[model samples]
Target chain A: MTPLVVGTSAIKRATTPELVFAVVRDALIAHAHDRTTVPPPLHLQFPDADGDCHVKAGWVTDTPGFAVKIATGFYRNPAAGLPTNHGLVCAVSARTGEINAILDDQGLLTAWRTAAAGALATHAMARPGAATLAVFGTGEQARLQVEWLARLRPIDTVLVHGRSKDKTRSLCEAFDALGHHARPALADEAAAADMIITTTPAPTPVLQARHVRAGAHVTGIGTDMPHKNELPPALFARAALIATDDHRQCLDHGDFGHAVRAGVTTDTSDTPVGLLLERPVERPDGAITVADLTGVGALDAALAAAVLRELAS
Target chain B: MTPLVVGTSAIKRATTPELVFAVVRDALIAHAHDRTTVPPPLHLQFPDADGDCHVKAGWVTDTPGFAVKIATGFYRNPAAGLPTNHGLVCAVSARTGEINAILDDQGLLTAWRTAAAGALATHAMARPGAATLAVFGTGEQARLQVEWLARLRPIDTVLVHGRSKDKTRSLCEAFDALGHHARPALADEAAAADMIITTTPAPTPVLQARHVRAGAHVTGIGTDMPHKNELPPALFARAALIATDDHRQCLDHGDFGHAVRAGVTTDTSDTPVGLLLERPVERPDGAITVADLTGVGALDAALAAAVLRELAS
Candidate 1:
């Protein structure tokens, strides 16, 4: 069968915040309930080009189609006036294995799915009435996490932290334009916020356990690669609860893996974020919660299937 | 940059047997010389649909672009008036990780490459002037094997062996149209031919060692998956020289693996087909040679790149 070639414009028109969040949430729950099949992702590194590509495929039992997504990141692309990321998702019929649609979303779907996952994990684990937020990156994810989470909870303040002063200031201004009281802050200052999300690709810890305030929730969006770490190992030891989008993936390359390898927490200590989303975990007074997300393919599949359905309608 | 979306017709227009053979040969040699980077392929099985999809990506050091190919086989599709296989290849700039072209060949390139590899292996390992050819399946590969091999060598007799009488007859007719003496043959009769190429996805051996004649060469092409075995394990034991494309992959999932697992051959007994292509292994009088091809990603990448270049020009 000839597949419908849906371009970025059509995909953007079909995508809604509600749709992304709902699909991502259901995908995570399905994964946690063991109803999804996600094979280990294929990662290709182009060190000479300062780029990497990830090929992820997933099948949810309830979805009509499976998605195989190719997402690439060229760290130096911005300097060449190109986007740092590019990708397309191929949706195939689960019954016939015939590709039905090529969603050339150009990495937008991945970004949206990631943001929704981070927001869901943060909202599910963070204490209620958490208003202040800290975002430790000046990239698309940092802005996305803060904005998407604001859809779930009230964010009265946003603390932006990054090594680049210019980019950090620009991100803070972007958040300010979104009507949140935003300003640049040091790592320690940002870590003290009520909700913290680390989105930097720092090879070393960006925040220490001692700097985070009590009753704070920290969601890690970076550290998807083995060489990346954004949270200190001691941070896991100080947490009241730890959660992960994918247990195996997060334990292999996520910050939780680093903490586990450092003996900060046992491998089995972290709970699946989907479980917490289904049945909210009790948050004690003055407790800290951490969520590690290394990304999951099931969310991509569900979101792609949902978007294709939306486009078809 | 906008990627060129070349459909099946365009792909077909650009593809030629000579181009396929040249690119595939270079890819094999590059792989043998460690001049290509091929990550482990991603395989997903959908038993409910009687389908499986394989995602393979590779980059040759000398190539300007890389390719990620998705090939799916739905064995039951033919009953629904659909082809049993479907696939596409995405070619990306290796220097930038930006997808530059999508060759929607719909599995044609894969079939051609497979056919080319089989013929190359058959010609490389078979005794000089070996003309009698026995193909153990009447599928596309079966026809292509006989035809492509005819391009490399003079085949005086073509033996088609398949379960379906009609298919076997049809294949023989096709070979007759191509001006070759073709007829149906049983296991023992076919195995006694100068060269044998097995193309059936049989879970058990299609031919036994005792049936194969001395000095005959066999190229097994269908035992790519772990559970599939096209050649008898004892067949490897009787062979004087064994060759394989991608030693690691062949040793893990190819017919070579079956032989090793069954204690018929040691793991180190098989030589890389690429090495044999570069320096032909001496064949003793009345000695048998066997080749196991599991399919390599580098060939896909190289072939895709060549096709894209052809389309552009």
Candidate 2:
């Protein structure tokens, strides 16, 4: 049988922020409960093209279908009038080994699911009624994180920090256009916000420990690869509570892992983001919290399945 | 751009045995010469459905495109009136990471590539003017091996060995229908043939060293996974020369690795099949030869690119 081919526009039309948040939330909880199977991703680097590709597959126990996704990034693509990312997800039947659908999302689902995960983690780990949000980097993810977070809670202020002043101004304008108070801020100034989210692909620390204030929650979203880091190890030493999406994956490639490798923290001090979603953790007065997210395949599978269900309906 | 979707019938019409042979031959040589990049496959197992899936990707240097392939096998599918294998190949542009086409061949490319590798290895390693061929296993691979090898050289007699008498008879008749003299024979009798090919997914060895003659060539195609072994270590001890498709992959999961683990042979003693294809090896008098094939992803990428090129033209 020919599998249903769902293109990017159709996928976008069929999915909503609420749908993605619910689906990704359930997936994270399922993963924490050990009810999902996600193999280590297959990564391929093309040095000549300044590009790389990642293939990730995951299956939730008792689900009707599984998903195999391919996401690629070519750093020079934007210079050629193309997006830096491209990919598709294949959803297959669990019983018959037949492909059920091909979600040619062009990495849209990846971005949305990642945003939902980050937003969920940030809301779950941060103190109640947190209003000010400081965002690092000025990419699509940075914007998505803010917009998705707005769907969950109220943010009174958004401080945008980026390497390029024009891009930073543009991102702040975008946030302002979305009916939020946004302005460009320096790294040290942004670090003093109520909640912080780092979304840069910088190789070195974008925010140091001393720059951050007490009672702030920082979520690291850009350090999925080994060489890319956004937070300094000294910051983890100050965080009273730390959370990770997946224990093994985050400990191996996440910002949390880098902190452990640097001897600032032990691996056992972190909690699963799923567990935090299930039961909110108690926060100590004047203590900081951090969440290290490397992204999980199970979340992608769940989100793809949810979108396919919506389309089929 | 919407990627072209090429289904099974179109893929078959656009490809020929000759085309596959040439494509796979060049890919093997490129892999041996370090001109190809093939990442280790991503494997997923679903115990509830008794199924597994393998995701492999590859790229040849200076090539126009690369391929990411998914092949699934559900052992229970045949009982439900479905084929045991299903899959598709995604061809992506190397320069921009844009998907060029999706060749939904339903695992046909994988089978054809495996057959081509086996046939090429057998023809190149077998003694000059060898006439008799014995095939172990009564699957599609066994039949394809015979047909593909016939394209490379002549076989005066065909000996078939199978556990099922009915399958064994049917296979022999199939070979006879193709105008090759064929009959059923025992393992010992079949091992004495000039060339032997084992295609069964047996946990234990199917042929022993004592059964094999002094001057014979054996190509193993079933031991791609760790638990599914076809050839015995004793057979490797009898083999004067050993050839592997990819040295690192073969040493990790191929039958050759099993033999090395059993203390039968060292890793360095084996030769790359591509090197042997470029410059045929000199055979010692009364010495046996064996080829261990775990299959290579580079071959899949090359074949998919070739078939896509054919379809486009």
Could you tell me how far off, in angstroms, the CA of residue B91 lies in candidate 2 after the best superposition?
A: 0.1
TM-score of chain B of 2: 0.98
TM-score of each: 0.97, 0.97
Give the Cα error of residue A84 in candidate 1, in Å.
Answer: 1.5
Could you give candidate 1's per-residue lDDT for residues A181-243 as a string of tens digits?
999999889999999999989999998899999899999999989999999999999998999
lDDT of 1 by residue, B83-180 (tens): 88887899988877888888888888999999999899899889997889999999999999988998998999999899999999999999999999
A-chain TM-score in candidate 2?
0.98
Residue-by-residue lDDT tens digits, candidate 2, B1-313: 5667888899889999999999999999999899998999988888889998889999888898899998898899999999988888999888889888888888899999999999999999999889999999999999999999999999999999999999999999999999999999999999899999999988889988788998999999998788878899999988899999988888888889999999989989798898888866799978999999988988988999999899889
True contacts kept of 2: 0.51
DockQ of each: 0.69, 0.70
TM-score of 1: 0.97
**Native-to-model Cα distance after best TM-score fit, residue A196 in candidate 1, in Å:** 1.3
Report the C-alpha displacement of residue B288, candidate 1, in angstroms: 2.3
